[model samples]
Target: MGSLALKDLTEKCTTKYKKISVTKDIILLKNYCHEIANKSLQILEVNLNNVESFKNISEATLALTILINRKRVGDVQYLKLNNYTLPQAVNEEHIILTESERALSKNFKRVVTIGKGSKAVPILIFSGCDKLKIF
Candidate 1:
């Protein structure tokens, strides 16, 4: 998935669930699944044999979300899904506002832009928590 899509998904999750804390790594994994889905869509046009890959990706994404919720409540120490160990955190930065994303929030206020030239796409802005906000 592109950075913009990842950012949008991350924002969506964080904003929608105000009580739950979402980490950067989880967002990255979600984006990876999204990319897989995108690839699967492309592959579907060529061959139906790739359908199983799409199913697996969907299952993995669901499992990851479940594990995250478990971890959030201090019920798990490590995230292990599909026989793979996921790091609690990633060193890479996940939040970087693009020009278009920045335009969605003017003067630190969330605004929805619509229609025509120079209009910003609507986006949710998360603040207060450093982990939630894209810098």
Candidate 2:
């Protein structure tokens, strides 16, 4: 009887899993992140219209952290940040920076203020998918 009960439970779980779709899961996750991003922006005194911006930043930061923690050397990742600048709080200690690249024609240099001090470090900032590559 115990074996029969276990089999029935397994079947129910399988059916429930089959009903779940990847697209739906992704949408749910994006919505959840949007909510959190909005709250974070409010705390930072950022405009409400920039909720999506914050979400993308959070996602990219997570991706970078995962790649660095995994020690995946030589793996290059790209992030797109159209016009959004890196927050003044981000520094080399926050995210591991290997290198950065840009054409000579560009006016803005990728740099971020570090810590409580006034010093700045070169940083490649990316938002959605415009022109930021991470190595």
> Model 2 misses residue 46 by how many Å?
8.1
User: lDDT of all predictions, in order shown?
Assistant: 0.44, 0.44
| TM-score (all chains, Cα) for each model | 0.28, 0.26
Over 29-106, each residue of candidate 2 has an lDDT whose tens digit, in order, gives 556654654455464464646656665646654444333233222222322243234434555643554335223213
Clashing pairs in 1: none
Candidate 1 residue lDDT tens string, 14-65:
8884455458776887677557655655665578677676575455444443
- RMSD from true fold, candidate 2: 13.3
The deviation in Å at residue 67 for candidate 1 is: 7.1
Give the count of colliding residue pairs in each prediction.
0, 5
Point to the candidate with the largest TM-score. 1
List of clashing residue pairs for candidate 2: 80-127, 80-128, 80-129, 80-130, 81-127
Query: Looking at model 2, how many pairs of residues clash?
Result: 5
**Model 2 segments beyond 4 Å from truth?**
1-21, 46-135
